[model samples]
Target: MSEQSVTYMDLRFHTPAEQKRKRRPKHTRDTEFSEQEVTYSHLKFHIPSEQQKQQTSTSAESTDYPTPTSSWLVTVILGLLCMALLVTAGVLGAKFLQLSHRVRRQNEELIEKQAILGNFTQLQETLKNCTNQRDDLQAQKANFSKVVSRKGEKCSLCSEGWIEHGGKCYHFSEERRTWKKSQEYCSSHNSRLLVIKNKEELDFINRLVCFHWIGLSRGGAATAMKWEDGTAHSTDLFQVKKETPGESCVALNAEGGAIRKCAEEFRYICEKKPS
Candidate 1:
């Protein structure tokens, strides 16, 4: 009891200076400890931990790389650009083809026009030549008319190779021709086919040539036979001996006058007035 009493008395009866000293030490310790804790918390807040550093670095990597959505979007954009380019190319190609076709067609048209122009030029040249020939023939016809107008002026009645009989000139042809062609030949020479006016003329022509075309034909079965000069044939003169069927022209020979087809080929006699 005495010792506990004495320690308790010492504790309770400590000096005010000593107590102040002790309390000051405790306050200083608390202040220092609190400041250190605040500094540690500040460092923890300012500086990153290992796990936080790893998470931050991973976030940065994710931000730097492209996502699948972004990659797909980029591919789709590229595809769209390619499609647009293709469409543009197709349009331009179509336009180019159309332009080429038009140019080719125009070229063909130009060639056709040139060919037609060439044909037209040739036709014009042919027309000019025909006109010149017609003018020359007209000039020759005028000169012939002047010569034939002077009749009974002591000129020769007939040219060479022509026979004069009964104030008419007669020509015998060696070449064979159809009845129509023979008449055309005689007309071209300013004459007509042989026309027998009487029995004497018929006999004369029969002695000259055989199977020769004369200018005697019937217009129809109801019409009588007539000469090329439109003179009617007198039935009383002589009867025409029929040699074949379908006869339309008259021929004379040593055997007498005969009826023959106009299309048959035969020598001819031409009769004309003395010029």
Candidate 2:
């Protein structure tokens, strides 16, 4: 038992609110001075500066989105520009193709013209050669005529009654005889039935104006008409009448030649080269 002194005991008992307050962090100088940048849509925020954020945030966030009308107008302008480019490209391509086709056609035409010019040049050269040859032949003929005109030379190559032509002698008979007998008569006279060599010879015979037997005959064949000298007969010089089966011999007339019977009687012509 002793005397007990009265003592006050301070006991700490925490409530839920006091416990939560103890868990919160305290703000220090580091937290207050440190700066952080924050982006909120188009607005910028800073940790340290509230007044500056308030001044600039309204302007930054208020930037306008384009209105529908202006958006459509810009889209239409871009589309029109694209369409113009496409149309211009198409026109250029078409023009280029057309020009290419025209150039090709012109080149073909020029080639054809060149070919025609070449043919014309060849023809001109050929005609010049022919003219020169004809001139030379004419000169030779003139010289030969001069030689043939000499006094006794004209009749020197021909018989008494025969005529001279083209280095040969021709005789027109007055007596009518069958074609075979006439040929025999000519053979006995060391001559043969008349053979025409060219237009000049045929013309000479035509001047005689009498139907005379020549060497052209069918020779017992229907289609194979030939001369007695065993040379091919030329149909271009004379229009020969159609031969009957029995008419194998040919006679010369002023117009052309005619087929006659071998046994028919007519005056005859004879031809012989100069001895």
lDDT of candidates 1 onward, in order: 0.73, 0.75
lDDT of 2 by residue, 78-103 (tens): 99999999999999999999999999
Q: Candidate 1: where is the Cα deviation over 4 Å? A: 1-155, 243-247
- Which parts of model 2 have CA positions greater than 4 angstroms off? 1-155, 221-223
Q: Give lDDT: candidate 1, residue 81.
A: 100
lDDT of 1 by residue, 52-164 (tens): 77887788888999888999999999999999999999999999999999999999999999999999999897567545644653564455345444432446598655666
Specify the highest-TM-score model's number.
2
